[model samples]
Target: MSEDAGRVPAEPPDLRVGHEERAAAMRALDTHFEAGRLDVTEYGERSGVAGTATHRHELEELFTDLPAPHPEFSPAAGPPAVPEKAPDRHPLGHRHTAMALLPLLAVIGIVLLVVVGGQPAGLAFFPIVFLLAGRFGPRRF
Candidate 1:
């Protein structure tokens, strides 16, 4: 048999979101909006997350149940859409030398926890030391 025979296949274009999943997400969105927990402007902005026609329709249905769409509404400023890149796009934001101490810190925490768990004051000091070490230590990065 060829190596490619082991590959799992893809679906045809027609299948999108399953109906039940769409309805549930819609219900949660509607409940938040209807409870006065969400204002109309906020609702308009967030409703874009539904990501499909069916999901939007479900929300519109819920809106129909509300008493009135309030007038004099300000259009909500949309939050910026954050663009994503592949993991390798950004170098891990760090100083090269700083990472050297991470293992040491872990060892310190584990040893302190094990050796000092029997003492109340030492146990308390353990976390304080760990936090201070994290702040001022780590090779100045």
Candidate 2:
């Protein structure tokens, strides 16, 4: 009789996984979700599982049905490659930041207009900001 017939296979060298490994697995999951391999709920559930996983096998299970992430995207190796420039760069990369300040700008304008112009000219700014936001808001930028 072969003495090794019943021995179990050994685990891979990647036995313990830290936060970075878990995060890399989640990124792969995200890519799959974006490609429509998984629905929202499935993505959320798997993401939660990946986030809490502490072992390599546990993380592997999350992507068992999906292709492995590219080596550049693998967290186990190192941080993912950063683009030379951001994926989407605005004129100054501050369009969104400026857009976010719209409300505050509107409020300040309203206060100034009401105080200086002695009219509700500030209220007029809302429509302009609203239009600007609609034109350059999340949908596009």
Candidate 3:
């Protein structure tokens, strides 16, 4: 009582009890996936990111019936609980200004040099101008 009463547990089994609790959470997740509440892609994705295989395996059991106490539990709680989340991420997708413009820039340069037969002395200068603009373009806030 003299020391801080609310200190983290400092023993191995107590630490393991935390793991057990996480396993319980995994079992809950398994329940969510089994009810068709979660799809294969989502189940796999979430399981892949899980901290332990025991958690991931329980997740698979959601798809296949494996006997357990209470088997799984679903809560009124929002989306299936993911103990971990994907790191800050952007979809690996194309931007219209990207795919649409890069090819055009190349095409125009090609046209000026090949189709136009390189007659214009200024044709070479255009690429340099575009390069400068791309390099130092103002970032729109």
Candidate 4:
């Protein structure tokens, strides 16, 4: 009956939703399912709807019947907080370059001793290097 009566009511704005939002919703759904709040059939149905949901509210609807597990992950909130840590690299792996060169040097020294200092000198060098390598090379135990 008013001047604005001719105008149609505006639809609710479609809040943007992405994989992060959908994944959070899924985690909430999983929590509820694990706690016996939702059955397999219901969980599967809600999970499917969540994965395909476009708006934020559409994803939120999947958890409407369940209680919130955490405030940060509630439907009203966006994505949950996930802390990232840098992977730890092997501490001793870098020393492998130097370790590899040790054997090559020992072989070269033995060859030179045989050519320049004769067989007796080369024979004396072999046992000394062998004992040193066994005693100081990479530990077995």
The C-alpha lDDT values of all candidates are 0.54, 0.71, 0.52, 0.72
Model 4: residues >4 Å from true position, as ranges? Answer: 1-13, 70-141
Model 3 lDDT tens row, 1-141: 746677754333212223544466556557767877667897676555443534334444444543433323232234557688766443633453454466457657756775568566645666765675565443364
TM-score of 3: 0.24
**Model 1 off-target regions past 4 Å?**
1-17, 51-141
Q: Compose the digit string of candidate 4's lDDT tens values, residues 67-109.
A: 7762133234446788887564546776854775676688788
Best by TM-score: 4
Worst 10 residues of 2 by lDDT: 70-79
**How do the residues 26-130 of candidate 1 rate in per-residue lDDT, one tens digit apiece?**
566677787886788867665655435442333445445445542111223356688986575327545534654664676576667667765444445556556
Q: For model 4, how big is the CA root-mean-square deviation? A: 9.9
Task: Indicate the TM-score of model 1.
Answer: 0.24
Which one is best on lDDT? Answer: 4
TM-scores for every predicted model? 0.24, 0.40, 0.24, 0.41
By TM-score, the better pick of 3 and 4 is 4
